[model samples]
Target chain A: MRTIELSDRQEKIIEIVKESGPITGEKIADRLNLTRATLRPDLAILTMAGFLDARPRVGYFYTGKSSTQLLSESVNKIKVNEYKSIPVVVNENVSIYDAIVTMFLEDVGTLFVVDDKSLLVGVLSRKDCLRASIGKQELNSVPVHIIMTRMPNITTCKSDDLLIDVAEKLIEKQIDSIPIVKEKEEGLEVIGRVTKSNITKAFVTLFKKD
Target chain B: MRTIELSDRQEKIIEIVKESGPITGEKIADRLNLTRATLRPDLAILTMAGFLDARPRVGYFYTGKSSTQLLSESVNKIKVNEYKSIPVVVNENVSIYDAIVTMFLEDVGTLFVVDDKSLLVGVLSRKDCLRASIGKQELNSVPVHIIMTRMPNITTCKSDDLLIDVAEKLIEKQIDSIPIVKEKEEGLEVIGRVTKSNITKAFVTLFKKD
Candidate 1:
C-alpha cells in the first residue's frame, strides 16, 4: 500500500462532490471549466482512494470516509498475539524480595502473580514493589499477594484482543502492563504480557514493517 | 494523506519501470500492450503515490521508494517536542524515599536528579528505586545520587530530535524514559521527557489524528 497527497484540484473535486449529489464526471469537469481528460485522473484517484464512490448509472458521491478513519482501521487490525511478550510469573505466596529479583532477572517491568494451579491471581508493578519497599514490613517475609493488584482489579486481555484497545487501557488505567490470559474452568491462565515497552516496539514496527 | 493498495497492473508497471531507464508513458504502455489513454490513470497514481516519478520529456522512472519507506518518512517527521512530557526532577542530595514519594506524587516512572545549579546529574527509574529498596541501605538516609543512574551514562534527547530516534534509543538501551535536555555552560538541563508511554500515545495519535 502507498499513501498519496491529494492535489488542490482533487480537494476541490471532493468539495464539489460533497455538495453535489451523484454528479457526472462531465458535469464536474464543466463546473471546474476543465476538459474530461484533465479531470479523469483526479476522479480515478478519488474513487480508488475511497474518498468517493462511482457507480454505473450514477456519477460520484462522497464515501464519508476520511484518511484518519482508514488509518485507524488498519491500526485496529493489529492483535495482542502479534506483539505480546512472554509473561513472567511468580507465585502469590512468594516474598516481595523474590518477586523483585525475578523482575530484575527477567528484565521486565511487571510480574504476574499466580496461584498453585498457575492461574493468574494478581499483578506486581515496580510501583507496587517500590511502595512495599518503603513500608515498615520486611520485604523478605511479606508475600507478593499482599502488595499485588489482585484479579478483578487487574486489566487483562486475550490473544485475539486488539492491541490498540490494550494500549488505550494502559493509558486509561495509568498502569505499566496487562496480562494476556486464557480462560479455563479454574481461572484465567496467564499466557503473555503487554507493556508500554511492547506498545512502543509495536509503534516502531508500524513504520519499519515491510 | 491516504493509503491505497496498488492494482496488479500498477505493480507490473512499477516492475517494468524499475528495469527500464527513464521510460516514457507511451513506451511503458506499449510494453504492456496497452494504449497511453488506458495507462494514464495508473501512471498518474504511481507518480502521485511516489512509487514513480515523471519528467516532462523523459517520461516515467521508478522513484525506488516503497510504501514502507514513505511510511517511515512520514513517521520520522514527528519530532520530540511534539510528544514529550514534562520532566519530573529531584535534587541529587534528596533521599531515595523522598524521590520515590515525588515519583508517586508526579505519577511518573522516571525522575531526573539535578544539582543545586539545576543541571542534570542522574536519572532514577522505577527499577532503580526498586533495586535500592531491596538493598541493605536505608531508603531515607541514602541519597538518590548514590543509587541513581548517573550522568555520562544517561540517554538524553533534544526537543528538536526526531521522536523515532528517541523511541529507538528506548528499545536499544532497554530504558523506560529519556530526558529531553538542553546543553548549558554548566551541564545538561532537563527540559522534558520521552517515555515508552509517550511513544505509545504517539502511536495511537498516528491513526486517530486528522
Candidate 2:
C-alpha cells in the first residue's frame, strides 16, 4: 500500500490557493510574510502535487482534486466487507437438479458448496452443472461435490482486505466471484462474497455525484 | 486523458537529485545559479508529480518512479494488438461436437463463430453447447449458431483500443473474452481475441523488472 500526506503548512497553502483564485507567488508570499524565495517551495509543492495549477503568467489557481486521485484513494480505503454480498451456498450433497434451482432462484452464475458443517468445501459454476447434466446423466442423483472445483483451488478474500487487491485477484484468476472467508474454529467459514457485480457496483459509484 | 509534462529544467533537476543523494535547496540553487526561491517551483513540481521526494529539514531525494504510474503508462501504450491472443474460430455450420472439440483442443472458453464468408457471426461457449445437447438433443446435428450468442450482442474491441478499458468491459459485462475485430464490407472480421488469460498475462508482465 502507498500513502500520500500533506504537512500543516502545505495544507494551509492549499487553502490559501483555494480561497484566492489565480494568485501570484509574490502576493501569496506577502500574505504569508515570507520572501518569494522562501514561499517558492510551498507554492511549487502545491502545484506539483496537482492541488494547484500554474500558468506562465496567470500565477496559480486551484485545479481541484483529480478523479484518479479520488479513485485510488477510495480503492485503498474501502474494504471488502463494506460492499460484499451474501454468498449463495448450496450443500455439497444437494442434487444437481436442486442446485440448479437454487442457482436460478438466487440468480448467480457460481455457487459455493458447503458441507453439513456449513464450511465452504468447493465451488461450482453454471457451466459445471450444465456439463454434468449432459449424456443422459440424471440431475436428481448427481451431487455438486462430484463436479466442483475443490479446495486449494478456491480463491478467497478477507473482510478487511483492500477492494482493489480483491479486484486484481478477480482479474488475475479469471473467476467470476471470490468467497470472503475467515478461519473459524470449525473451518473456513464463508462470511460474504465479492463478485464482478460488486466491483461493477463500486465502479459505478466512484464517479457518481454525491 | 490528463497530460503531465516535465519541463527541461524540471528534468535536469531530477537528474541532479538522482546523482546526488538528499541535496538541499541552497546547494541546488548554488549549482543552478538560481536563488533558492527561483528553484522552489521546480522542486515542488518534481516532488508533487512523484519524480522526487522532499523533507524540509533533510532536503530533497529521489523516490524513483511510482508503480501506479508505470502500470498506467504501460496500459496506455499496450493495445489489443500487442496483448491479444490469436482468436480461436469455428465455422457457424460446424457440428456442436466439432466446435466442442475445437474449443477443448484449443483450451479456450469461447470460440468465435464465422459464417461461410469467414465473417464473425456469433460466439459459442461450452455452456451453450451443453444446454443445447440436453433432452435427447444430438451434438452432431446441432449447429453452433443455434446455441451461440449472436452478433449485435457480442462485445468487441479494436486493435488500437486501450487494454484497461477492455479489461473493464470483460469485468463489467461478465464475459470471459472479447473478439478483437475490424469492420469489413461483409461484416465484422475477427482479428484476434483478448481473453481474461491475456489480461492476466499482461498484468504479470507489468511487475517484471526491465
Candidate 3:
C-alpha cells in the first residue's frame, strides 16, 4: 500500500462528495468549475484509496474512511503470539530471594508464578520484588506467592490476542508486563510473556520492514 | 495522507518503470498492450503518491522509495520532547533506602541521580535497588552513588532527538529508560525521561490519531 497526500482540489472534492454524495463525477467537476477530464485523476485516486466509492449510475459516495484509519487497521492485525517471548516462570512456593535470582539470571523484567500443576497463579514484576526486598521480612523466608500479584488480579492475555489491544492494556493498567496464558481443565497455564519491551520491538519493526 | 493497495496493473506499471524508467506513458502503455488513455490514471496516481516522478519531456523516473519507507519517514519526525515524561531524580548523597523510597513515591521505573549541584551523576533502576537491598550493606547507610550506574555508563537523550533513535538505544542497551538531558556548565541537567512505556504510547498514538 502507498500513502498519498491529497491536493487542495482533491480535499475539496471529498468535501463536496461528503455533503452531496452519490453525485455524478460530471456534476462534481461542474460544482468545482473544472472540466470532467481535469477531475478524472483525482476521482480515480479517491476511489482507489477507499475514501470515495464510485458507481456507474448513482455517482460517488463518501466512504467516511480517513487515511490514518487504515494504519490502525494494519496494527490491529498483529497478534501477541507473533511477538511474545518464552515465559520465565517459578513455582509459587519458591523464596523471594530465589525468584529475584531467577529474574536477574533470566534478565527479564517480569516472572510468572505457577502452582504444582504448572498452572499460572501470580506474577512478579521487578517493582514487586523490589518492594518485597525493602520490607522487614527476610527475603529467603518469604515465598514469592506471598508478594506476587495473584490470580484474578493479574492481567493476562492469550497468544492469539491482538498485540495492540495488549499494548493498550499495558497503558491503561500501568503495568510492566503480562503473562500470555492458555486455558486448561484445571486453570490457566502460562504460555508466553508480553512486555513493553516486546511492544517497543514491534514498534521498531513497523518502520524497519518493507 | 491515505494508503491504497495498488491494482495488479498498477504494480505491473511500477515494474516496467523500475526496469526501464524515464520511459514515456505511451511507451509503458504500449508494453502492456494498452492505450495511453488507459494508463493516465495509473501514472498520475503513481506520480502523486511519490513512487514515480514525471518530467516535462523526460518521461517518468522511479523514485526508488517503497510504500513502507514513507511510514519510517513519518515516524522519524516524532521528537523525544513530544512524548517524554517528568524525570524522577534523587541526590547522589541520598541513602539507597531513600532512593528506593523516592522511586516508589514517584512510581517511576527509573531514577536520575544528581550531585550537590543538582546535575545528573548516576542512574538507578528497580533492578539496581533490588540488588543493593539483597547485599550485605545496610540500605540506610550506603549512599545511592555507591550502587547507582554512574556517569559515562548511563545512556541519555536530548529533548530534540528523534524518539525512534532513542527507542533503538533502549533496545540496544537493554535498559528500561533513558534520562533526557541538557548540557550545563558543570554537568548534564535532567529535563525529562523516555522509556519503553513512552515508545509504546507513541506506537499506540500512531494508530489512534486522526
Candidate 4:
C-alpha cells in the first residue's frame, strides 16, 4: 500500500471522525475551524488512505476496523515505558473479602497477591470474591491464597510493551486488562497494569482529537 | 448511603448517563424521548442515589469513582460468572517479536506464554516488546522465555472474583488488565482476561437504555 501522508488538516479531520463518527463533512469542517473547500482534499486523502469512509448523507465515519489497525501501527512505534501505569498489589494473607473490598475502593480490577517477602505469588479478582461468597465461604476466615489464581499461570506485560499489543490482547482474549511486571534479581515483580480502558483513552488522545 | 428507589423515568435517565456519560441533561432527555422537564426529577433521584452526576455545562457524565462505590455495594449481589472474559495465550517457543506482533494484531496488551502442555509459564506484554526493541535486543532470535516475566510472580483473577474487588485491583495497581485462570489436572490454564475497559463497559451496560 502506498503511504498516505496526512497534513495537519487531514489529521484533525481524522480525529473529528473518531470522536463523533457517522458525522457529516460539514460538521467535521465546522469542528476543526476549516471550511468545506479546504477540508475536501484532506478528506479525499484520508479516505484514499483507508483512514476514513464517507457516506452519502450520514457524513464521514471512521471505519471501526481502521482505528485498530492505525493504533497497532502507531503503538508499535512507541516505547512501552511511555505508557506504563502504577501498580496495585495484595498480600497472600489478605482475606478474599478484604482484597475484594480493596479492589473496589481502589477502582482497579486485578490485585497482585504477594507473599510475606513481597514476592509475587498469586492474583485475585472480583470473580474469586463472588465464588467465595456464593460458596458461603468465610470471608475473613478464608485467606485469598485459598482461591487466588497462582503465578506461572498469570499473564503479564512488561513496562515497554506496546499499547497496540495491549489493545490486541484485550480484544483477542476478550479480556479487559493486563499487569505490567518487571524482572528483579529474585523474581518477577509487579510494576504496572494496562487495561483496555487505558488503550481506549490512549487511542482517544492519540487519534481522536486534533 | 440510603437506598434510592428509581422510577422508570429515573432509571431511563441513569441509563442514558451510563451509556454516554459526561453528557448534558439536554442530550439525555433527547435520547430518552422525553423533555428536559420530564427528566428533571428522575435525574435528581439518580444523582441523589449516587447513580448519576450532573456537571455545570458538560451535561451528565458517569462518575467513575461513584460507580466503583455502587459496584462495591452491589457486588455482593452479582454472581461470579457475570464478570469473566475468555483468555488469549501464546506458546513458550514463540519469539518476543512474534509475541509483540501478536499482541498488536490481536489488540491485546498481554500474552500468556504457555508450555506445550498448555500450562502457563510466562507472560509477555507490549512493554516487554518495547524494552527489547529499544535496547536493540535480538528480535527474531530472542525467545519469549528469555524475556518473559515468569509465573508465580504474575497477578491474576479467578472467574469468581467480585466486580468491586476487581475494580480496586485495577485502580491500585494502576495497571489495565488481568488474566482469569482455572486449574486443571495437568496444571493451571488461563480461562479468561479482564481489563478496565470490560469493567467500564459492564458498568455502562448496568444502566443502559433499553
Docking class of 1: acceptable
- Every candidate's DockQ is 0.44, 0.07, 0.45, 0.02
- Mark the 10 consecutive residues where model 2 chain A has the least summed lDDT: A201-210
Arranged by lDDT with the best first, the candidates are: 3, 1, 2, 4
Global CA lDDT computed for model 2: 0.75
Q: iRMS of every model, one decimal?
A: 3.1, 9.3, 2.8, 21.1
Best by TM-score: 3
Give residue B40's error in model 2 in angstroms: 7.0
State the lDDT at A157 in candidate 4.
Answer: 79
TM-score per prediction, in order, is 0.81, 0.59, 0.82, 0.37
Off by over 4 Å in 1: A5-39, A52-65, A208-210, B5-66, B208-210
**lDDT of candidate 3 over A1-210, digit per residue (tens):** 566667889899999999999899999999999999999988988887778999889999999886566656667788989999989999999999999999989999899999999999999889988888898768998999999999899999998998988998899899989899899999999889999999998887776433
Candidate 1: clashing pairs of residues: none
**Chain B TM, every candidate:** 0.79, 0.68, 0.83, 0.63
Model number with the top DockQ = 3
Whole-model lDDT, model 4: 0.65
Error of 2 at B43 (Å): 9.8
Instruction: Give per-residue lDDT, candidate 1, residue A98.
Output: 91
lDDT (CA) per prediction:
0.87, 0.75, 0.88, 0.65
- Tens digit per residue, CA lDDT, model 2, A45-81: 6666567888878788988774344434424667878
Q: Is the docking of candidate 3 incorrect, acceptable, medium or high quality?
A: acceptable
- Over B1-210, each residue of candidate 1 has an lDDT whose tens digit, in order, gives 556667899989999999995999999999999999999988887887678898899879888776555556667778989999999999999999999999999999899999999999999999888888888878889999999899799999999998888898899899999999999998999999999989988887776433
Q: TM-score of the candidate numbered 1? A: 0.81
